[model samples]
Target: YKASIPKNGGPQIPDELEDPKAFKLKMETAIQATLKSEKAKGETYSQDEKELMIWYNYHFLGRGKPTTHIQVLSSVNNEQIKKNLPPVFKEIFARISSKLKHQS
Candidate 1:
C-alpha cells in the first residue's frame, strides 16, 4: 500500500496495519454498504461488484484484468482523487483512450 502524506504535509501512520482485525471489520462494513447501495440503484450490481473486485484485486491482490475492455484504474488520476474522492466519490466515467497502463 502507498503511504500517503496529509494535506498539512504532516507525517502520518497507516492505521490499518495497526489492528488487522479492525481493518477487516472496516472492509466488511464498506463492502456491505456498497452491496446495498449498488443493488438499490440498478440491476448492474453483480457486474459492478465484479469490476470492483477486479480493480481492487489488481491493487491489493496482485491480480490484473480490465473490466468490459475498460481500464478503470488508468481512468483515475491519483491527484484527481485527492480532490474528487473526498467527502464522497465523484465518479469519473471511463472514456476510451489510446493510453492506459496495465500489468498482466
Candidate 2:
C-alpha cells in the first residue's frame, strides 16, 4: 500500500529537519522528482482515489492544544472496500517519526 502527505495542512516540515544539514530540502527534492516523473505525468492521481489508499491530511484545532493536528484514514477491514483493490500511491513523508529527529 502507498501513502501521501498533502501539500496543505500536512505535517510541518521544518526548514532544517536535521541539524545544519538540509534534510528538508533533500526530502522536498526527492518528493518533487517522484511526483513530476514521466510515469506520474502520464497518469496523475485524483482526490477520489483516496478511498483505496492511505492519506494524511492536516487540520487546525483551537484551545490550548497544538495549532495543527495530523489525521490518518486507514480502514481496510471495512466490507465496503474490495479486498482485491491494491494501493496506488507513493509515500512521501509517511514514515517520518520523532525518533528520526536529533534533539540539539
lDDT of 2 at 21: 50
**Predicted candidate 1 versus true structure: per-residue lDDT over 1-104, tens digit per residue:** 12232264321212567986765454444444445453333244564563354334334334223341234445667786566453433333322222233321
**Model 2 per-residue lDDT tens digits across residues 1-104:** 12333446344444453542554343433334445442333134443332111122222221111422222235344453444434541132233434356442
Q: What is the C-alpha RMSD of each candidate to the true structure, in Å?
A: 15.0, 17.9
Query: Using TM-score as the measure, which candidate wins?
Result: 1
* Model 1 alpha-carbon drift over 4 Å, by segment: 1-14, 37-104
